[model samples]
Target: MGWLFLKVLLAGMTFSGLLYPLLDLSISGKTRAPKPNIVIILADDMGWGDLGANWAETKDTTNLDKMASEGMRFVDFHAAASTCSPSRASLLTGRLGLRNGVTHNFAVTSVGGLPLNETTLAEVLQQAGYVTAMIGKWHLGHHGSYHPNFRGFDYYFGIPYSHDMGCTDTPGYNYPPCPACPQSDGLWRNPERDCYTDVALPLYENLNIVEQPVNLSGLARKYLEKAVAFIEQASTSGRPFLLYMGLAHMHVPLSVTPPLENPGSQRPYRASLQEMDSLVGQIKDKVDHMAKENTLLWITGDNGPWAQKCELAGSVGPFFGLWQTHQGGSSAKQTTWEGGHRVPALAYWPGRVPANATSTALLRYCSIPTVELLESMGACRLSAWTITRPSTLLGEPKLVMGARVLSNSTLPLSFSTWKTMLQKLRPYREEAPSTRRCCQRSPGFLQMSFKTLLMTTAPERTTLRTLR
Candidate 1:
């Protein structure tokens, strides 16, 4: 009997030893890490059909398609607003633009700045013990008060608004290229030029101008390099970070890759998209190579795709009933149509979020904060946001119509418009900085040469201090 009891006890011990590791893993899976890095890549005006992963007939984006294959995608993601500034407002404050006092582009210059009353995601993330950085277009505001530096980003780079929004019809020091030239009508041009700060299209680092009216591609590479460095830094320091990469592509004067430019049609757009995909691939490889599979990476466009029509570029897909009282131009390109807001979204955290996990939870650009995204990370609580109301959090849909929440202005508040808005929006928000005060002001030189740095080796980083 003693011998039999001894055998049973030894067997139980063996079994427990084998199960111990598995039990620990199960418990850890439910717990939060000290901190995890977050990467949000925002593509401008890219459409639902534009991605190779989607069923778009003309566009071709292979790397993006591959990402979709490797990760999960939401067919119904949305943008905060159709236009750049409003959308940016929604992204930053997690509230509708109307809530912040913006309704239309009619008096865009005077009204569209991101109000100081509201806190931005950058500020929230920074307060949560994460480093933040913003790269690409910042269409929220231009005044010193509305500038990115004051909004919570520790570092800032990229354009202040739409590439051509500020381009003038007049050709002079402070003016734009001659609109008199017929070539200007339907031509590809950079709105970035020398301004009071530096060149109008200058590269801004924090509050200083790093380069004058610089080319976006060069700046994009610099931004990416800095982001990668930030990742390395974050990993080494054991602090979580939020890296926002705003890509200026598939939008403008139709700047396609040279190969695609030869075709100068949808194909050019395809090429540009593919290039952007390649850049994404580069970032992904870097992160996966450097960190464990637990890091979260999210990629999506800011709004709908734009199509080139006679002289203006607007939405590509058929997005009906998008314009409100003050906004216009075309259907979905900037409208509230599904094509306008139904941009693509992909999230990945190999070990955490289930691979190929298709979440149709009706994600809105402004609702990201309500996703318990920060809480899941053990971050601080956020104050009131228009999107994260009690109803929405309780598995109920927030009625998304009516006037601006903060401004008290009327809007085209209707179910159809709301549906269109929800269907068309993508996963985008104004980027918060990854770290405070990282980008020293720079003096940029874009016109020195126009050759693209793409198809070149990876950027290892060089001194841009002299440019400033």
Candidate 2:
């Protein structure tokens, strides 16, 4: 089953690459323009409800909401994985954890990152003559060859891992509130606090450590400055560029610039969210000024908020995952629940993407369609397909008709679907021993089945049903 799934995933990626040019030609008309600059802004630990446009109760993301209004919003977009490293690896490689060899978060002291053999999106774009730069958190690998520079990013800036992973001069606002790094050479250990205080967080510029024990308060400003400069430089050079900004806004140890209007009224998380949104707005403005008609700005989160952070974490909105919560475990961040994987996604391209549109088609990280979209843009080739009508690239929900459905009597389904199916089969709350065992082991089983479903393609409908 594993081997078959791997082959299907590889085939899907290859097929997507081939189909992307046709989709691109359908949008850009008969005369093709230069390759579009791609700006992908990735939020760390941001929830599906964090974007104000997605959920009404949370009103911090003004700029992001504006972006959504002027672009296409995806309601059913999901991260490749629930955790950090694996999700990031999948995003860059267009492969799952099983194929990418990164199933969990990489440690600060970890020697390896995403395996060197795997090709990255940046690498592909770079090969196609695009300038690639990555700013912000890069948790894939920090050591020698596993670094972003080695991974095909022309230039790299920001922390090697999560901000909270190591102690810094300005620790910012965490749940328990971590202390500042000691001035003395000796490492500071707090028996009461669970946060790290020994090694200081280092800020990187390319391969060099520009700042040790980075000032959390000033980091946002620095990131904005660097990102804007990169975009301007690349635009002036007349080369299509790929700028991947992995933001640190919605994550813990929230460092927010104080609001001028009301200093003490707002929460820290909301303040930080506003700061993040403002930074995005500034970047967007820069893109508009330099290359509005030829750049695609895509924004999304790595995964859901860290539920363990309580008030500090972002809201998950409707994906509360009540079934898991009833069993006394978190359904956010590390779990396979909707709250853990479902994230807010927006795509903005002034004349290219349809404005104020929403798509409900189910999508996950490293999906064939996404890969096709990126490769189509990066490859910069137009297909024989003629542009007859105005439409957005991946702006509408894609329907796959006449496909096969493979299922077992106890099929692995989505959380909501699984609940309905389970109730029809047997009461989940009061289940027999065999049923309980099946339910306990269904998360991983379901994920595998879901991937297979996404990759399967055929001429005629075929149902593979088996009795367990």
Candidate 3:
């Protein structure tokens, strides 16, 4: 039987001094103090096929392609969810969206936000003596305890939610509104749940509102400018930093600098993608110049494109989405298909990450803290706790949410030790109530096996896959 599995991965530094304890400590006795700087460039609604390395027809992403070739390319990396708010919640907390109470996007009128009780990656890194800054879209929550600054980031700058909202002129706040749709003062309420009314979108600097109805055309450039400044400030302070550039580009209402918007060659949407590539290159150049060997850089999309937007939303490569179909099945940004959450990830850490390596290992955004803690070599710890409050029935079909206790586990400092333990546990699977087993073969780059049980009424639907 063909086993279906989720591929998760974490990139380690290639530094000889810090390499031993992370992967396999028995191989070497040396351990260096880790103070590596981290920069996460998160693209909004970009697809796996949007990169030049993944799909040729899209704009050339020379910098990202170069980064992928230089460091490690994760072919099977996945976000926790297909949509923005939920996926972002999972990315930061390592818990599923349902568990975090952020199962859907937060509308301006909506009272929901990422629960303040959950621990974010920023909080973990902050405790580790690293400065953290957040730039760009922060859909987690717009107000109160859920704001970025309140969450963990020492500095926050960007919009509170998606860009396509809060427009008085655009009907339903739909950019390039459908001509056929009737337009009357354009104040029509959006059909989607958890979305706000068409009010002017505001840009925030920390907790204060800086710009209302922000100039959508120059948002990307603004995000980049803030990111570079943060990097420079952190680098000059001689402190380890986490620069989280949550870019707002390649999403709907595509915008770019005039020079990049060559009408004949690159469409506005494609230009936005290219512009993002340039931003990535700029960040890499800065990092290389400042501390090439002491920094770990990551570039990836939050999730797949909004298939409903057609070419404006970008491409998802071989995978399918909500509006797009491949063969006989359908997959899209809001679904559980690979095209929805499987995004392209590029990790570059000079000397530590192998050159031009591709890893098919199962990697999820939730494992980010694992990577952060492991990369820092116990320089930080994720404090695990839970709150058992009354469940809030949210999302479609109204299901119970939150109020579950979380048990935390840590990865061993030795890979071989963990591998042996996994092997020993393989034999006990048959005796257990649920089905579970390790794979017979390992994968290229880095390999780790995980067992999964599929509970279903149909016997044929029940199966497992090799995670490695």
Q: Highest lDDT, which number?
A: 2
Lowest lDDT 10-mer window, candidate 1? 445-454
lDDT rank, highest first? 2, 3, 1
Clash list (residue pairs), candidate 2: none
Off by over 4 Å in 2: 1-32, 258-264, 364-468
Candidate-wise lDDT, in order:
0.52, 0.72, 0.61
Looking at candidate 3, what is the lDDT of residue 305?
85
Assess candidate 2 and give its lDDT.
Answer: 0.72
User: Over all chains combined, what TM-score does candidate 2 have?
Assistant: 0.74
Tens-place lDDT per residue, model 2, 215-310, is: 988899999999999999999999999999989888889887642345357677888888999999999999999999888788888888999898
| Candidate 3 positional error at 117, Å | 1.2
Pick by lDDT: 2 or 3, better one:
2
Query: At residue 263, what lDDT does model 1 achieve?
Result: 56
> Per-candidate RMSD vs. true structure?
16.8, 12.8, 17.4
Task: Report the C-alpha lDDT of model 3 over 13-100, residue by residue, as the tens digit.
Answer: 4443455465566533355355778788888888887876555454468788778777766545567677888877766765566566
Q: Write the per-residue lDDT of candidate 1 for residues 69-116, one digit (tens) a residue.
A: 566555445676666666666666545665656544422255437767
